[model samples]
Target chain A: MFYVPVSSSGGDTVNTGAAITPAQYVQHHLEHLTLNLRTFRVGDLQEAQGFWVLNLDTFLVSLILGIGLVVFLRFVAVRMREVPGGLQNFVEIMVGFVDKSISEVYHGKSKLLAPMSLIIFMWVFLMNAMDLLPVDLLWRILDLFGVTYFKNVPTADPNVTFAMSLAVFFLIIFYNIKIKKFHLAKEMLTVPFGGYLFPLNLVFRLIEECVKPLSLALRLFGNMFAGELVFILIALLPWWGQGLPGGIWAIFHILVITLQAFIFMMLTVVYLSMAHDTH
Target chain B: MGINATLIGQFITFAILVWFTMKYVWPPITQAMHDREKKIAAGLEAAERSKRELEMAERKAMSIIRDAKQQATHIIDEASRHSVLLVEEAKQQAKEEGARMIELAQHEISREVTQAKEVLKTQLATLVVAGAEKVIQRHLDASAHMALLDELVAEI
Candidate 1:
């Protein structure tokens, strides 16, 4: 439902409930436009939408954005010359940055890590930037097209965050196993205490290994979710009142999104480093 | 709100992105960046080398110019000295020619005066013979007196 913004500046609208209840508005905003996995149809059949459900909004947004990112980087990649120009200079700045970060952390000779970090940072930054959009804008536009329950920000969705984290998690496990070989298992048993406490060490190591993806996912999901929530709540404010708090939150959220993306990339590189080095 | 099949889709999307990045995006851009870095380093090195060469060339040009200036000054001084020596030689030749002309004229004048004096001596002996003949009131023999005249001339 499209919202009619505040007309009177003197009073509050959340309590007044003009077109719909604020609770309903907030709930409607939070819901994702989902595709039922079992039926393989994009519908709002709430009954069977359980664990078999897919958030189509999340999937499509992430996919399109992911492709967009690839195309963008590829565009820069192909157009790169010995002498850089306008767009080339800008993209190269980012490329140089990610390259340096990768070099700093992961000393191993792998080409994918910088690109991977570039994708994560830029794509996540873009996804998280959706929170900065007027929360009702996409929904209102898409609602006009008979689509409802759209959550625009992909990073706000736990699935997307988890997907990225899972990838990083797999990389960490892969490199640890690939590089350390038998030594990883040995360290897993005997690092903290002694070899006599191998059982306790194993349990501790398993928990620690499980926590990496969980922390990365939840940290990103939590920040973006909160940012999205704050924007929605700000949109709930009287239109005249929304400007100040909304602008401030957005200004602050820019830092959050960027920092979150950077942190995700940084942690991934660090994990890669840990997996790479013997220590 | 809940974990579901979206994770699989996202993971699939994630996988595609990772593949695309690794295949197309990462390696080429990384290579381009590395290539650009090497190019820049090479360009700088070339620039530095050319700069050194330019400096050396400039120093050499300056020295050449200085040497040319020195040679020019030396040539100018040599020309002036030669001109001065030529002027002195012309003056010395003019003075020697004037002295020789004056000596030739003086010698001719002295020789002419001696010849005139010898004529006067001969005339004076003839006059003395006439006067003696008149005083003795008799004619003297000229042929006999010729030898006397010659002797007198010698004495004179």
Candidate 2:
């Protein structure tokens, strides 16, 4: 028989070093590669490769969230009628709310923005909801299958969130191009600093576009990662200390998770709306 | 950190989810909401009908009560008229009976008075006859008195 050592702290027994020190565990989860060694190119910025790597947790969780979103939507679709039941009713309320928000932000036509906003809300909500799951659950399951190092939350990973934001950013750019064309860009460059300073105008606009994806990704990743951290710290508490506080925190977290998802979805809709706008 | 194979998976998942939600979910949810609203409206209509029926029943009850009161008043008036007629008939009959009785009593009295007068006249004539017979008997013979009495009888 093997004995697992559980330590008592603050008058409550907690399962601690039988696994790993709190700092090491947190560090292992937090650490990211400052640079991507494989993507190294001479022309690439010197600071790029050493930049923090993608957080695996955020990516995996987001994938699950995406699937969950589809399934939920499918279920709602199956149950739709001339009259709504419980789940259908709830989904309608959510859709209506998201639709209203998009309508308010994106004015020209409801056709594109309405559907897009609904999609964003449900998808991001699904992603944010992923934080509700225990951080180690997937890892433990994977460990059973001999894979010990799987992180399950994709939104927490800077790379994945940034990638998602960048996709939206690119779509925005594409729409702007489609709406305004080359003339639109020329006009924009000529407006603020005048056509004479075209170089600076172009440079500034490029920087602005680049920052959109970065901000979008960082915002989502930061909020979700913080929530995850809170949960982890709660889990580290002993018996009454850990269990009670963890329960309390988990309850509060339900709102945080849902809110974060909603914010992310709404922002996406706003960005898309802005992209479609003319001036 | 790097653009690895995972990015492909992520993009694929996003596309699939968006497609599924658009195709499978939105139409039905909208339909269900509409149906629920219709059902609620129907229920309200049903409630309104029942309310109208209740009002009609209430009106019917009031009419029935009004009719009963009217019938009762009519009966009372009829009863009063019949009683008056009965009393009037009885009084007329009583007056006729009294008149008849008085008439009969007057006739009897008249008859009695006439008979008495006749008796008295007869008595006075007999007395005068007796006195004349006495005088004639004294002055003449019995045969003469008889002859006189015979003549008197023939004349009457």
- What are the C-alpha RMSDs, in order, of all predicted structures? 6.0, 9.4
For model 1, state the Cα shift of residue A197 in Å: 3.4
Off by over 4 Å in 2: A1-19, A30-61, A110-112, B1-3, B31-156
The residue-by-residue lDDT of candidate 2 on A1-279, one tens digit each, is: 111232231111224335566775664444332223455321122333433333344455666667776687777777676655687668888877876676678776534445555766667666666677776666566545433245455666665666667667877888788877877777568756998998888888788778887788788788878887887676566646766777777788788777776777777777777777766
Q: Tens-digit lDDT track for model 1 on A1-279?
A: 334332222123322225776787887677787777676656363532578898888888888888888898889888878778888888888878988888877789766687788888899998988888899888778765666567899999999999899999998899899989999999999978779999999899889888999999999999999999999888888889999999999999999999999999999888788878884
List where candidate 1 sits over 4 angstroms from the true fold: A1-20, B68-155
What are the per-residue Cα lDDT tens digits for candidate 2 across B1-156? 344444545656665666566566655555666677789999999999999999999999999999999999999999999999999999999999999999999999999998987786687568658867786778867676777766664554
Best by DockQ: 1
The CAPRI category of model 1 is medium
Q: What is the C-alpha lDDT of each candidate?
A: 0.82, 0.66
DockQ for candidate 2: 0.16
Looking at model 2 chain B, which ten-residue stretch has the lowest summed lDDT?
B1-10
TM-score of chain B of each: 0.62, 0.51
Please write out the lDDT profile of model 1 over residues B67-127, one tens digit for every residue. 9999999999999999999999998988898898889888988898898778876677777
Clash pairs for candidate 1: none
